[model samples]
Target: MTHPMALPVVRTLNTDRHRVALQVFMVVVVAHWAEHLAQAVQIYVLGMPTSEARGVLGLPFPWLVHSEWMHYGYALVMMVGLILLRPGFVGKARTWWTAALLIQVWHHFEHLLLLLQALVGTNIASRPVPTSLLQLALPRVELHLFYNAIVFIPMVVAMIKHGKPSDEELAAAPCRCAPAKV
Candidate 1:
């Protein structure tokens, strides 16, 4: 005869697993959305006129856009599997969370430079803005900064919440694949 307590313990564990999965999903989706929007604005709205051309930041524009989506998709799907299939990842959630924030920070800077060029470059001056992306009268530079602060800031906060660990806590965590005794 088992104790009645066993079922509640099982339910709590399952609940935690679901919560972690959702958190991971949100991180990936948000990252992909930002990258896609940035790419679309530059390529379709700015009218640089060629997908093969380099972006203002000197990146091959279409390649950057395509690669960003592919990378995000791969990471999101793999992370979901890791959370569900692998027990160790849950315990090591901090590492995964930090990695997500780091990737976003890199992307934030990349887009920042592109926005700067779009607002001021003579090359862009000749190209008429598309009605679909944004009105020409709006300040593109300010808009970019505002979006960076509003959208990416939350992602950074979530990453720090999920990933950070005290020095002592990290020290106590066992090293991967402990050496076998002779």
Candidate 2:
């Protein structure tokens, strides 16, 4: 009943291209998490000054860590990945993936707040640094960690469910994320 070209791009992405696209998206997400973890380790374990503990990528291009544009861009990318790749999932996997996407909506909003402050040259409550709504209560580093953990956990759960899908899920799947049964 669907038009042939109605959602051709989405259909292709969800079918043949889904596996590669999801893998690439995951790599970026994991790499960003690694950067944050590296920064935390540098400060806590290596006893480096907080300001000097630039993460792996930040060591070479420090602006990557400091720029609100960069951070917001990443949030935007995460949301896009979650949205675009969603149709490939089915059953429990779809539910879990949507959970991640919903959490990311708030996460994206936080980054948008920071980016807007940077663009407007005014921070929330006249603070010295750009701040998010939750940043008012939690330290920035802890907040970022918290956000990553919540998002990553659900995503991992979705991936695992997708991989070991029920027969119904397997039947309904649009992509070959799971192995075929003999």
Candidate 3:
């Protein structure tokens, strides 16, 4: 018998509910991507200075760009969301989802390190800013863009695969991502 606590979680991740949850998660992920892309365009395409190139929401709340808490919170959300939605995936979708989850886990760790440094008042490499390890090689903005890209690509692939699952995958899936017969 399923544990009482697990029953709700299992139900949430099953069939139609899982698909709806995934859709909501994907919308959030895409919105974040749009923000990052907007920031990048402001920097490269529009020739705006980095400080002035804050994305849509960042333009209104510029402090968000420098807020380690905000960054860490988003990272944590991504990690948790990926994990929670993972059980709904099967076969190739599961593989791709796992890949995204693994990358997001590392991304979360980097943000966590940055958050800890911020709390302790010691930035990485004695730099003035909170620095991720990769930030040493690339600017923070560019580094995040790369990280998001890598995570997003596999996630998109996973969604595509989920939509047109193999017969075995469809059989294994508790959710209905596949199309119905005419």
Which is the leading candidate under lDDT?
A: 2
User: What TM-scores do the predictions have?
Assistant: 0.28, 0.95, 0.93
Best by TM-score: 2
Per-residue lDDT tens digits for candidate 1, residues 1-182, read 86322455433333444345545655765664555455456657876544543333325444553243344444445344333322222234445544544554444444443444445553344554311123244454334334445444554444443344344433432222122233
Worst 10 residues of 1 by lDDT: 173-182
C-alpha RMSD in Å of predicted model 3 compared with the true structure = 2.1
Q: Which of 2 and 3 is ahead in TM-score?
A: 2
Q: Write out the backbone clash pairs for model 2.
A: none
What is the clash count for each candidate, in the order shown?
1, 0, 0
| Per-residue lDDT of 70 in model 1 | 42
Q: What residue runs in model 3 are displaced by over 4 Å at the alpha carbon?
A: 1-7
Give the TM-score ranking, best first: 2, 3, 1
**lDDT: worst 10-residue window of model 3:** 2-11
What would the per-residue lDDT of candidate 3 be over residues 17-111, giving only the tens digit for each residue?
A: 88888888989899889989999999999999998998999988999888899989999989988988887889999999999999999999999
User: Distance from true position, residue 147, model 2, in Å?
Assistant: 0.5
lDDT of 2 by residue, 51-166 (tens): 88889998999888899999999999999899988988899998999999999999999999999999999999999989999999999988998999899999999999999999
For lDDT, candidate 2 versus 3, the one ahead is 2
Q: How many Å off is the CA of 50 in candidate 3? A: 1.1
Clashing pairs in 3: none
